[model samples]
Target: MPHTDVQMDTHDIALETPPADVFMAPSICKSDLLAGKSYSHFSPIPAHISDDMTTECVLGVDEAGRGPVLGPMVYALYYLPMELQQSLLADTHHFDDSKVLTPEVRSSLMRKLCTDGSDLHRASGWATRLLSARDISAHMLQPAQYNLNAQAMDATIDLIKEVLAKGVNVKEIYIDTIGRPEVYQKKLERIWPTIRITVAKKADSLYPVVSAASVCAKVTRDAALDVCYEPYQDTAVNEDKATEASTHVAWGSGYPSDARTSTWLKQNIDPVFGWGNECRFSWGTAKELLEGKTADVKVDWPVEDDANGDMRMTDFFAAKTEAGGDELVDWFGKRVTEEMEDF
Candidate 1:
């Protein structure tokens, strides 16, 4: 009887259909498989796969909204089959760190990747809840960094458990380093002993799996922002409240160093709401507000200068009065001297 053999490729396992004569008795290999001819021929697979039968699933984890002044921390997990890794990498060639991609490009890529059917499993979790500026101010809460780090880990672990429940065989977990890579890995190991955790700097940019996780996390957070904006718009219009307007206003970046965001914070200082309804009170912007600092005091707009280079309030009035001193007095039915008397 002729020997039978099986071959596998990166994308799939190719099983050769046996010949008709094999119906009586199939030839089977009784000797141990040679290293070069068996699984050892290919590079070692990710640890997530054990005994060739278990499906190899890579769990990519990433967090979003870490730098935002408002909104909860969002962590997402993406479980993708190891076989599809190469194809996914090719499809998302433009994929890099989510921070590096423009919002428009990120949105376009996200729509394309999410629709593809490749046995992908995903889960996301938000922080306990968005800490309001009022709560922070009243309780004298810790800095934003403390709150953010705490929430990030909380969301991450919760999402991991969710993916596990969905029957995803998560063998290895990759997380983009948040505070310190080594420290985070140690912490994560304590929570999940069975899983191998790799925390690396800019892992999302370096790994396709991590980048896919990032895209999903960002899309989910952005959707939450849309929901947050809806209630804010309703409050601004129906309540006839300008203070509420600042809450919903998309102040550029919403960071303390941002002039527009700082100015908005200063303009709408509410003891109850702190800087603004949406402003994260634990941030430096809220700290400045609590210290009674004003954004307008930071810098002043340039004033126009007259011909003599002296700063003038109205260039039009000065230029026009000099050109038509007599005509201006006649039109107003008043003498130039009479008008200048008050000045």
Candidate 2:
């Protein structure tokens, strides 16, 4: 993956290694939250490079917002030269698994990394794929192409590709996994024939690189949710009420178990659209509310989009044409030809 310089005017927003806040107000489409992808770079103004540089870099991959019913799922990658990985990341900075860290600490560390003068900024580089809720729902809802695991894998791959394109020499990769570690490891090994890959349970806690990636992923997700707000196009929600609704909806952690998230879903569901693009419709919590709680709507399934699979009343009674002979055949054939066109 190649890196791009995303210029941010403020200190709070996540940078690209540079990529959030707790309870921050959602900004309305400041950038495309749903379309395309974003990445960050964190290194000295003139990135250190040498023609004879032989040090292979270690990289880690981790994600946040997977369980959340709302907000984008974030995949982040943290990479630095392999030799300096532990000394700078673990001993110097004390980076650890993001789950155990408080929101304040994560935000603070990410902020420092974004700062130009910091040692962490000079030594490390990171990037993220902000997989939107709308994209996730649309993928899962599609009958033939639906699979969350595959979707996650693709996001990771895209991140790595972007990193390599940006001139990072990643020789070894570590990943924290939600699936069978051996299986995931084997899959990634097959994908990247040359790079050493390890997918493990709690890899984030064990490896500083993975832990760094976790912070990048976790903090980006939190900030994304913090600034998450839907545009006020909905006619049912009054502008005054909608403006009131926008300020801190208190969707705690975006997990289904969070009482605040559940309460927000119930109180804010649109009935017709369910929730804003922030909420994933494929998730059980969102789906159940839309189907069981909202008013019933009659739907015609198996929508006819293609030319095949069309049936008509004439086709149904075609077998009876044998009994009626030529007279019936002529009557039914005429009806079938004209009506089949409509079907």
Each model's lDDT = 0.49, 0.70
**TM-score of predicted model 2?**
0.73
Off by over 4 Å in 2: 1-29, 34-46, 49-54, 230-247, 293-343
Per-residue alpha-carbon lDDT of model 1 for 232-265, expressed as tens digits?
3434444554354324334433334445445655
lDDT tens digits, residues 240-341, model 2?
A: 656432344366556666666678888777757777667777887777777764544434468668654577767666544456644555763465666789
Candidate 2: RMSD over Cα atoms? 10.3
Best by TM-score: 2
Candidate 2 structure lDDT: 0.70
**lDDT score of model 1?**
0.49
